[model samples]
Target: MKAPDFDYLRPETLAEAMDMLSRHGEDGAIIAGGQSLLPLLNFRLAGPERLIDIGRLAALKQIVDGDGFVEIGALVRHCDLASSEAVARAFPLLRQAVGHIAHPAVRHRGTIGGSLAMADPAAELGACCLALEAEMSLQSVRGQRWVRAVDFFAGIYETALAPDEILTAVRLPRRGPDSVQIFSEVARRRGDFAIAGLALVADNHMANPRLALLGVADRPILAEKTMALLANNMAAADQAIELIGNEIDPAEDPAYPPAYRRQLVRTLLRRTLMELLP
Candidate 1:
């Protein structure tokens, strides 16, 4: 099915785009790469009155390296992130996770901002964002504010973004020299949505770990109980693995049941800990 008719407004600048969004409010939908929105539009899942196109706004396409974090502009394509040497050095897990986002064609067109805004429960980037403890830059005609990755995701296909606000960029903290990143997912096939995926970032000894899992809950979620266990003592692998079931609330699905997902999470946690801890 084709998308419903909508007025298309292309803003020449980021400010103009925000202003348009502010005026239209709930009636408007922002379109950058359109990789995520177009599908919804085509399926008639979303029927906004206006399409505020920010695809040509050059300001939101830059990847800036900062003192302690890398500010990746919202419009940066997945392909760009997958190929970036800077991203590889600063956040290798993100670089690895980018490889799991659809195929090259989709990666070439899909934007990081689009992925984060879509907030798909099974998407790799959202899980990576949580593991990296990234911050999202939200801007509107009113003002700008930063939301941590943990607080940004509200639920399935939902976010903390106000209708008038746009996610301009993401601030991903650089991993320390002693840090290790582990990313693995169980997918039916390559490029398919993950049945269960884990993104774990921690030190060599598994201290101060940040573990986020996808396809096991309503949103990419942090395994808080498991992390707390590891932080308290590095030798709590067996107990931490058991806590995975408590931390995540995976919905029952015909294809991937909650039990299967819980087991996958346990397997991933156990396997990664073996490699990292000893």
Candidate 2:
């Protein structure tokens, strides 16, 4: 099936994109990478009246490093992030995580903004962002504001971004010298969406650890209880692993049952924690 009839608008500037979105409102859909949206359009699952192409907007493609954090433009594709030396130096976990996101061809076209905005809980980036406490930059014709990763995702295929708001950038704090970031997942096949995944950011197991799990619920979940356990007693990693079953509510997919997915989470979590060892 071909995409339904829609007016294609290519906006050259961020301001121009904002105005286009404001005019189209709910009827318009933003297409950055088109990795996710094009398939939906081809399947006839989504039929928007307008396609606002912001792919070429310079503001959304710029990656800037600040004193305390690194800001990635929303339009930055997976391949861009995976190949970024800056991203590797500052946040190696992200570079490692992006590798698990489909194949190279798909990565070349999939945008970080598209993935986060789509809010697929199974995707690696969302969990990584949650572990890093990345702040989402959103803008609209009215104004702009930052949303915490935890708050940005509301549910499956849903986000806090209003109809008029476009995700402009994602801000990730610099990894501390003592921090260790771990990312791993279990999937049926390589590059396929993981059945379960884990992203862990720990600073000597004393500071508050950031733990996020993917494909476990409606959205990426921060494992506060497990993190607390590890923080209080680093040796309690074993116990924290066991508590994941009780802590998260993973859905029952037809391919991977709920019990198996939870088990996969446990396996991935254990594997991730082992990385903390010398």
How accurate locally, in lDDT, is each candidate? Answer: 0.90, 0.89
**Across residues 28-93, which tens digit of lDDT does each residue of candidate 1 receive?**
999888888998999999999999998888999989988989999999999999888888888889
> How do all models score by TM-score?
0.96, 0.97
For each candidate, how many residue pairs have backbone atoms clashing (under 3 Å)? 0, 0
Worst 10 residues of 2 by lDDT: 201-210
Best by lDDT: 1
